[model samples]
Structure formats: C-alpha cells, structure tokens
Target: MPWKESTTMEQKIEFICEWRTGNHTITELCRSFEISRPTAYKIIARFEEEGYEGLRELSRKPRGTHPNATDEMVVGGILLLKEKHKLWGAKKIHKLLYNDFSEEKIPTVLTVHNILKKHGLVSPQKRLRRVKPIHPIFDPKLCNEVWSADYKGKFLMGNKIYCHPLTIADSKSRFVFTAKGHYKENLASAKAEFTKVFRKYGIPQQIHTDNGSPFGSVAAIQRFTRLSYWFIELGIMPVYSDPSHPEQNGRHERMHRDLKAACAKPSAHDLKAQQRRLNSFVKEYNHVRPHEALEMQTPASVHEFSTRPFPEKIVRFDYDSELKVLKVTRNGSVRWGSYNWVYVSASLQGKHIGALEMGNGIWRIFYRNVFLGFLATIYHLGQAKLRSNLI
Candidate 1:
C-alpha cells in the first residue's frame, strides 16, 4: 500500500493518524502503509517534533542561504565596476577590486563573470575555434628567449592617411617593446623601428613573425625577406607562423585585439597624434594592466632586457672547410657545376652560401648556418641542369 503519487499528503496524514492509535505496532503499521521502516520512523519522528504541521508536506526548498553564497556587497562592487569600465571583462574588474577590498572579500574571476552573466550584463561571444600551433619548436622559457613582431592591419587616420601599426612584444613576459606607427609597411620603416628596438632592449636570440612582406616572402628562398637577411646578419634567427594560421601567434594577436579597441576605433587626427595615443597605450599596457598569465602582474614587472646587444659590425658567416662556398650573383643566380647557373633567390643576391654534398646528385644548401633548401643537379639528354628547391 505505497502512498499514491497524487495524494501523498492525505496518505501521510492517514498513516500518522493510524499510528497514534497504538493498537498497531510500528512494524505492522509500516507493513500496512507499504513503506520502509526507516521512512515510517522518519515520519513518526517529524510528527512528534512538529505535531500536525510536521505531518504536512515538508518544504523541499533549502533552509536559509548557502554558506558559500557570494555576499550582496561584493556583487554591488562588481556591478559598479562593470558600469564604470564597460569594455573590461571580469579579470580586469577583479584586479581593480583589490584597491577597495581585501583579497578575501573579492570574488574570483569566474564568480565575477557569473555575477555579470546573471545580471544580463555579459553578452556571450561566439568562440572562435583555433588550430594547433604550427611551430612547436620554440617554447620560450625566459624573457627575450624569443620576441614576436607583426604589422596590425592598416586603418585610415583622421587626416585620411592610412596608418600601419608595427608591434613588437616579448614572448615570455608579454612586454610590448614598441608599437610604432608607419605610413606604410615597407622595409625602410620596419628596419628603422627595429633598429630603435634593438638599440634599446638589445636583440633577441630569435624573432617570430607572420609570413608577410618585410618580415617574410613565400616566393623568396626560405621565406626570407631583406629584413630577415638583416636579422640573420645580426645573429638573430627569424621564425614565422604558418601562412593563413593566426593562432600560431596567438599571444601577439590577443594583444592586437586590445590595441585595436583602445586606439583604433576613433583614430587620432594625424600620425603624430596617433603616435601619442600608441605611446600612451604602450605605457598603460606595460605598467597598469594586469596579465592573468603573469599571475595578475604587469608585464613591466616580469620582463627583462635581452643580453645580446646590437653589434657595431655585422659578422660574416664562417663555413666548414669541407663544404664548397659560392656567392650569389647580382642577378640572384649561383654558378653551379660548370656553366649551369642555379637561381637561388633574388633576396639572397650578393650573399654567400655554402653547399655540402649529401649524396649522389643532391646538395644541401646553407645561408649562414641556416639550411636554405636542396640543390639537385639533374642531367637530361646529356645536358646538366641545376634545380634549386628553396624551403
């Protein structure tokens, strides 16, 4: 005789009434009620404690508030800060909360986000799916172990001139070295800005960049542009993200999102004014902003200057004694195996490279210490033809 689902309250009341008669034993009553002994005894205990009211349906709702519930005062602080900095997210707000409240009083980043979401203040953004990192070889363990540089997409200034922003940042510490504004993204402008960076911060061992003009060229040998060659001359290896894959340079890209929001929306009237804005952004980004990756510390607090200073004179590559060395011709061709001119790359013109014979007809090419590609000397119809396979 289990209690009917539709009339549980009536059945419970009837059982309590029947139990009070004392003629039926608790076990006998339990059998009659078709309920377990524990359940029967629980109902009996509730009736004794609270009388008829206890026999009525007990509230399934929880008692009082949860012990771990967030305080209304903290929620008020988060809402106030959100209204103050409309663009900022929970992490930044949480960091700012430290100014007014103790660490114990402040909510976590997730908690702040949840509060915002509950209040309908947070708009859900579509998550962009990312690809695997293209080059997993370079994992920078220290400051200046590597540095990333890229030209953010060009935008029109108030004076109608297109401003291209070239940004450079340390990979490990996330310190922005420079955010230079240029009329165009060309070799001269890029080189000048980099020279300033190198002189100030010292040169990094490796510089990471996207496969684009001034930094790289897919058509050129080993994707080396003239700027890249200059880097090699100064003992800095130039690395590139895979073509069309922006996630490989995700940290730098993330910084660009902030930069765009802060500076580019309502662009400054002129290049000089825009430059001032950029300078302000650099100062704020390095000193004021707290990075979650750096344990809520500013980049300036984490970054250290690179040890490799800019050299006064560029050092020439010293090749192994066994390998044959050849200088690239003015026309970008290297004379290989008697009269056959192998076109290496126009970018490599006037540069000396070494060739080590790997096997039968394939020769391994080297520009400085970097492996350029394969140089295969093929003979067809009694005529020897040199084919350059540039990586």
Candidate 2:
C-alpha cells in the first residue's frame, strides 16, 4: 500500500486525517501508508506537537555536534606549527603533530588542511600533471637494487656563491644515500661524495641517472662518461633516463623538490653551514619523514644496506676462451696490426676488450659484456685497410 509518488504529501495528510477520525487503528494506518508502526506514531506525535507544520518533514540534522570535534587549542597549535615550519604542508604538519603529541588527540590530514584554509594559511593548489612514461616500468625489487643520482641545479647561497647539490637515493626503499651540497658539479666533486656513500652503503646492482655531466656525457656514444665507465668497472650497470624527460627519474626529482623546499629555500652562508643543513635534512628524510608511497613508513624502516661491499681495488672480468682479446692502448686505440691503430674510448684504455666474430671479417667488440662496436678489417696492398671497415 505504498503511497503514490505524485501525491505523497496529500496522501500522508489523508492518512493522518483518517487516524484522527478513529475509524482505523494505528497499525492499520501504518500498513495503508506502507510505513512502520513507529513511523506512524512519530507522525501522529509530530501532528499533536506542531499541528500541520509538524506533520511536514522536520530537519534531520542534530541540534548539537559531537564533542570530539577539533578544539580551538588544536586550531591554534596548527597555526603555530604552520608559522614555525613555513615550508611544511598539511600532511607534514599532521605528521609532526602525531610525533610531538603522541599522547594527545590528533587531527586528520584533511581536518588540518581545512583549519589551514580557514586561517587563510593554505592557498588553493593547482594540480601538477605528470607526463606518463611509455617505456617499460623498471622497478627495483629490493633495497640497493637500483640507486638514482642527480645534480639539483645550482642555486645562489646567502653569500651569493652558487652551490651545486649532488643527490642520490635508493629507488626501492626511498632511502636517501647522499645529499651532498657540492661547490661544483665536476667529476672530482661527484666522485668524492660517491666514494663516501659507497663506503657506507655498499654497492648497488644499477645506478640510474639523468644524462648530465659528471654522470654522463652528451657527446659520448651510449651517453657514457668517465664516471659511468667507473661505475661499470665496479660491476654496477649505469643507466640514463630518456632525454628531456625528468619524470623518467621522477622519484629522485621529487626528493629534490623536498630538499629544495627544506634546505635550499634559505641557502646557507657557506659550504660548512650548508652541509650542516643537509645533514639535518638527511636525518629527518631518512629517519623521521614518512613517505606516502611506502605506506607511510620512513625510509630507514625498510631500507637495508647492500650485501655487496665495495672492493678495495678495481675488479676485472675474464672473457670466455673462444672470444679473442684486444688491449686498448694508452692512445685510446687498439693495435689492429703492426701500424694500424683504431680508436675506442679513452676510458677503455689499458682495458681488454673481447671480440666476438659476427660473420665474414666483421667482429663485434665488447668491454666486459657492454657492446663497443663492430669491426671489419679489409686487406689492401698486402696490408689491412682500416678505411670504412668499421661496421
């Protein structure tokens, strides 16, 4: 006996009117209205209390809100924290609140954001669109399986001196291995900091980097540089992101953002002072700051040191017996015969390259599994003609 959708109000009025006449019991009226007995009693009670006005629907909202709502003191505390750590956003503030007031009630992230919005502290954030990578996803399964390196663009410190930051992090665990603020982005500066990190964290299976100086050379084939060669020599595969695409190295870039916000915003007066700030940031980044991607766990909680320790000296690889070996001379070339010297990379000098015969006279050369190029020796005038023999 559901009421017609077209005349619901009129039908309720007629039903109540019928009850008022005492022709039918409340239970029978409820069945006619397709409502429960409690609903019928409530309607009658409302009609008795407020006449026709009460018979109409009343507001369902509670007159009083729950007492567990955020307190004025909490609002004040959030503002105070926002003022103290001007660079921190709502999530960071919330995390700090939990850390500082573990025994007290803490507000949710959205609640904290609302409080900030009410106080005109937080501005409307524009969504940052990321360019999706079309390449196959490369995920490091364990800690130290892959490490990312980058040089955050140099910024002027308080002393008006430019400081080039060298940053490296564990890809899987989001653990920061090094965040050294170097004076320069040259090979010397990069090597020193990397050596320190290697001594501490051991070696990773692969080192991923942007195609930049010290890490790589744009002119070098395969984007290989001296530093890249050194990494390969250490048995670590050095990889690069696609050119002009920062999102390819997105994780390291995101860390750079935080680092910039936390430390570089107010650049230190000198290297020593800046290093101290970097030290503090590293401590918090690794041990205190929670990453949303890691299920809100700090990097230190999940990151384990790599088992492969850095060797005391450079390690060499022995080739198979069938593969022929060629020694790259100091001039960055191999003695193909008595007088013919063809160029390889200077970085490969004094190193043995394994030659695998492809077909005909053409042979493929490799410096420890890394492909160098193909070589074809053509004999002319009773001697091998170098010519365009390189394939």
Candidate 3:
C-alpha cells in the first residue's frame, strides 16, 4: 500500500520533529522519505534554530541588509524623479537609480510600477477621449506607391517674414520627395513645386495629406480643394488624415518635429535664408540620419523613383463602348440612363459618361476623359428621370 502524503507545512514539520527526536536516524529517514542528506539536515537545523516557527516557510532573504526596501518609499522616489525630469520610462528610471543609488540593488521597472500601484501613487495614463483608431489603409508592397505631403508649418527668418516649407516623403521607403518651399503657401505654388517633383521622380499611385485648407477642406472630405484636385485629375488618389488627430499622419508629423528641432535656431531669419538652411538639412536627413523605425537605414538608401512617367498631355478616356450621358451644367450634376444625380465637378460635364462593369452590384462613373468617382446602384437608381418631352 502507498504511504499517506504530507499536504501542509505543519504536517511536514511534525514528521521532521518525529525523526529529529530519535524516532529514526537522519540517514534512515532520508531513505524512507526519498530526500537527500542535505535536505534532511536543513529541516533538522530549521526546527532546532526557531523551534516550531522555523519549520514553517520563511523568506530566504537576509534581514536588515536592504535598509531602504520600504515599498511606499521606493515608489514615492520614482514618482518624484518622473515629475522632476521630463524622462520617466523604465529604462530611464533604471539609469537614474544606477547613478543615484550605486550601493543599492534597484528593482526592475515592473517591480517599481507594481509598488506604485499598491500605494496608489501613480495616475492612469491620459488617453484621447473621443478619437477613432486609425488603421493604415494602404501598406505599399513596393516602394513609392504612396507619398505623404505637408507643409512643416512656418518659421520666421531674421528678416521677419515666415518660410512655409512643403515636404514630401515616400510612404514605403520614407525617402523624402522634396523639402523646399518659400513663404508662398498657396495651392498654385504647391502644384508648381509638386509638378517639378513628379517630373523628376515620376507619379505615385496616391499621396496623403492633412485636411488643412491648403491641401483640403473640412466642408468636403472627398472633394479635392486645389492641390489634391489636380492630383485626382492626374489619376492619383488623394488620402487625407482624420480631423484633429495629428498622429494619424505620424510619419509627416515626426519629420516636422525633427525639422523644427534641427532648423529653428536663433540666427535663422527670412524665407530665403530659411530655405537655404532647409536644403542643407534635407540632404542630411535623406542620406545621413538613421531612422530607428527603418532599422537604422537612411531614407534615400531604400527609396526608388516610380516607373510611371509624367505625360505632357493628360490622358483622356473615351465613352465609345459604354452608356454615355452629358452633364448639362457646371454644378457637376448629371443625367444618367434614367437617373438625375450630382457628381464632383463640371470638368466631366458636356463630356460623355461611361459606365464600367465592376464587381457584384458595382459600377464606376467616368467622363469623356477622366474617371469621376463611384456610385452605388441602389442609390444611383433612386433619382427621377428627366425627359425632353416634359418641357
């Protein structure tokens, strides 16, 4: 028959007590209990040293060695350090402890935070209350499929005028498309500058920007204001960030911060001088600076220009094969097979409209030469038909 097992520490202590009081010799007890001599001796020694109390489990840590191990005090000090210095993550805190308390064994960051929680010394992290989570809609499998563009705000030069810089970066390679601009922040000026860039680097599939008035407008999320409208006319999709969330467009935002830190100095003054400074910095940023997110690779090293060439004359499609409709007014409102509907602009009016067969229940609307946009069949069929016989 199998022997009964000792479940609790007290039962084990009683068994040890029986052996130590001469019920059995140490070596014989070790054989019966299937324990080593050292284990048997440890139990015997513990019982002798503190009577029955020692037989119970006690912390193996030495007493009075760490004079400053109070949980509340340690957590308090960490909070103080975090508040005093702008730096306060685990790695930073570890470095601080190493510098300040060389003789003490600093606890891990997890341990420090646990202590803080126990004493309620730390507050919960502040999070944006009403912001929607942004997921990256397009991850370019190839370099240069998409590029992000924006003006890195403006800075005053020594001449007291502001320099508005327009920056463009490849979404995949993080290669800078361009980083030069003057005080001119208008759409026409931006278009001219981007035209030059497109000529050199070729056209990208899409370009992303914030909803700033220069790039787009809050009133119309899909309608291209001016800079974006031109791109759409040229076959490039314009992507816009969510309103009020700068980090949704993180790459451009990060670059702007770095540019401000590097270029905004005491001596810089007018727009021209600032442009010169920006040119120099762009060279360094593209070729020299290592990006942590890119595995320390310089942006230029990984970036490749797109293969699509910029055509001198914008290409126009014909409505020969499909159903055609003439938009009668400049309001972008149009008359289709049996339905009257509004569209983006008159750029497609007076031009033949073509319907391209897409997936199940989907169709693309096009003008004499350009793709206007998409419309759902259910919604497109709901409009009243206009007849010539109705006067």
Candidate 4:
C-alpha cells in the first residue's frame, strides 16, 4: 500500500515553486510554504537531484561509501583509541580518528563513546566523594537538576579592598544561579543573599556546599550551621565535603577557578567597579560561553527558574500525630514515643519536638521549630554494654 499522509510532499513542493515564481522572497516563500530556510533549501536540492520525484523524499542515509567499512572495523578502531589514550574523552577520540583516518569512515564522538562503553573500556565518572547519594545528583539527564554553590574566596580589588563572591549554579543544566559579591564571608551575609536566590529559583532538592562554616560545619559532613539550618528548615538538604577535600566539591571549585580567571584577576579600583565587570562576565558565561559538558550549548538554553514558590514560613512537621507519645523538657532532651532523644542545647526544654521519620534506621530530632539532629538505631547496644561491663 502507498504511504498515507495528510499533505503530500509533491504538493508542498509545487506550492513552494508557485510562490517563488510569483516573485516571493526566500523568507516570504518559506513563510508561505510553512517551512524553514534550511527546509526550503532542502526542497530545492531535491528538485535538482532527481527532478520532482526526488523532491518527494529520498533516503536520508549517505550513499557511495566503501562496502569494506564494516561495523566491526569501526568498533575496533574506537577500542584501540580508548586503550592507547585512556585519558582522552570522546571529542579527543573523534579528533584522533579524523586526523588518523579518512573523514568518510570516521564516526561521531558520541558513537565512539558508545562503542567504548559497550566494550567496557571506560567507567562513568565517579560522583563527588564527600556528598551523600541523596544530595540531588546532577547527571544532566535533561538539564537543570542541580546547581553548585560556593564562595570564590576573598581577593583584593585594585584599590586594595577585598571582595568575596557567592556563587550558585544548576548542576545538571550548568545554569549559573548567581555570581555576585558579598561584603564578607560570614554566615549572616551569605544567608541574606542566598535567601533571595532561594526565593527566586525556588528550593532545590539539595544544595552541594563546601565545608565552610557558613554553609556547613567541621563536626559533621551533613550538619547544618545557622545558614544551612535555614536550608533544612526550608526542605532543602545541605551537602558538605570532607575536610580539606576541595576536589570532592569539584564543580563549584572549578567554577571558582574560571570566575577568578575571567573576572577577579582583572581588578578595577573598587568593589563596585569590579562587580560591574564581573556581571558582564557572568552574562557571557550563562548566555554565550560554550560548555563542553553541555555539548557546547549555552547554559541558558537548558535552564529555567523553578515554578515552586519559596514559603515565607518554614514548613513544620508534626510528630504528635505520627508518634504515639510526645515529650519536651527544659534541658533540650526528649523522652517520648518510646525513645530517649538528646539535643545540642539545654535552652530548648519545655518546647514541642517534631520528629521527621527517615527510613533505614534513621530519624531527625527536632526541638520546637529548630532541627536538633538525626538519630540512627543502635542494634548491638545490649551486646556492647555486656562486653563493656565484663571488661
């Protein structure tokens, strides 16, 4: 049976020719034919290739390649490159193939990577070391799932005044959230500024942060300081890197390097002027700078602010209904729901405790409106106690 269609390709071609013969401009012809410039050019090419018949629809596959170029040969070449240059990425592999072999036989970089992966020649890149698995992994499956956050550290302007940049990014989309200066690197300042971002962008499921006091603490990898505590209160999990492990949070670290190279190094007389210049660079970074991870697309093309609104009041979870019992004491310790809970401060006694259930033997202990910390079941406690007493 002939292929059934709503509109015939021949008819579309005839329309294009008629419009052109009537002295319609290329743009006007394209508009009248409901086609793009490239599509119009394709139709014209078809008309020349095999006359009107060719204009109907030819096979998209390229023709006249050597029959000897088998799939196995292409796979073998890709595997050889992977073995020889274990460090080279897909683009570099493609370049090597183009430089070494004829262009007609060479495949795309994506195809090369696919072949390498199929042969188990390489492993996927490891995730950030210090981050928890739940901290919004940003594989860029489509775009804009995660955004990196950090301060660029402090540097002097031409006038010798210091400027500290607080940066945020979309991890999956590679969209730059913000790249503006803060008066200082303190928690209050960082919180005040980042609040604006949370308000504008809505809350990300998780925000990856370095082991800085403002974003995190030295005691625990996922512990929240005052600013990060605010994030937790807002339903955003705070992720932290191990101490002295800057590379664990490599994305933000890398961005800082690029930001410094692009904006901070070329210092102006004051922070205001330097910031003005930095703003321009940020605009370029988001709208023009080609990202290799994004397949050379600008970050803006793959990013948009989330529609979820940032609630002015922090969301409160009620444990009274979930737990069989509820308790509060002036000493910030709670004995309720058949469990004993200890909190950091003694001042929170007599206030209500909210318990958020985290699965797999974990529970978050909260006092009044503040989240005290998490708790995990100690299954071998009786055995350890017996051993200790025996000792």
- TM-score of candidate 4 on Cα atoms, chains taken together: 0.53
lDDT, candidate 1, 1-391, per-residue tens: 4566768878889899898888899889888878889889889899899987887776798899988787888889999988976667899888988988888878788999999999999978999798554664467999988999999999999999999999999999999999999999999999999999999999998999999889998777778988998998999999998888777888899999989888899899999999999998999889978888899899999999888999868986799997899999988888876867778878888889899998888888888888888877776654444444632
The C-alpha TM-scores of every prediction are 0.75, 0.76, 0.56, 0.53
- Highest TM-score scorer: 2
Question: Candidate 3 — which pairs collide?
Answer: 157-269, 157-270, 158-269, 158-270, 317-369
How many clashes show up per model? Answer: 0, 0, 5, 8
| TM-score of predicted structure 1 | 0.75
Assess each prediction's global lDDT (C-alpha) against the native. Answer: 0.87, 0.82, 0.68, 0.66
Which regions of candidate 2 are displaced past 4 Å? 1-68, 100-104, 129-137, 376-391
Candidate 3, residue 211: the lDDT equals 84
The candidate 1 region of ten consecutive residues with least summed lDDT is 382-391
- List the candidate 1 regions with Cα displacement exceeding 4 Å: 1-86, 114-121, 127-137, 380-391
Worst 10 residues of 4 by lDDT: 382-391
Model 2 clashing residue pairs (backbone): none
Candidate 3, lDDT over the whole model? 0.68
Query: Is candidate 1 or 3 superior in TM-score?
Result: 1
Model 3, range 1-391, lDDT digits (tens) per residue?
1223665475556567668578687777767766678876777788778877776767897877575564555556677766653223444454455545543557776766666566565568888688676766567778878888998887777877777889988888888877886677887778888888889999998888888857877654254565665676677888878777677778778888777776776437666667777887788778866566676667888888789877667676546665544554566566555645645454333444565657664566654444545655444346532221112
Candidate 1, clashing residue pairs? none
Top candidate by lDDT: 1
How well is each residue in 1-391 modelled by candidate 2, as lDDT tens digits? 4456867678778877999899898888887778788777877788888887777756887689768788777777889989977766888788778655643578889999988998889967799888664652368889988999999989889888988989889999999988899888898989888888999989999999988898876556567778987888888999888788777778888999989988888889998899899888888889977788897778999999999998769976899887889898887777776767667667677789888877877777777878766676665653443222232
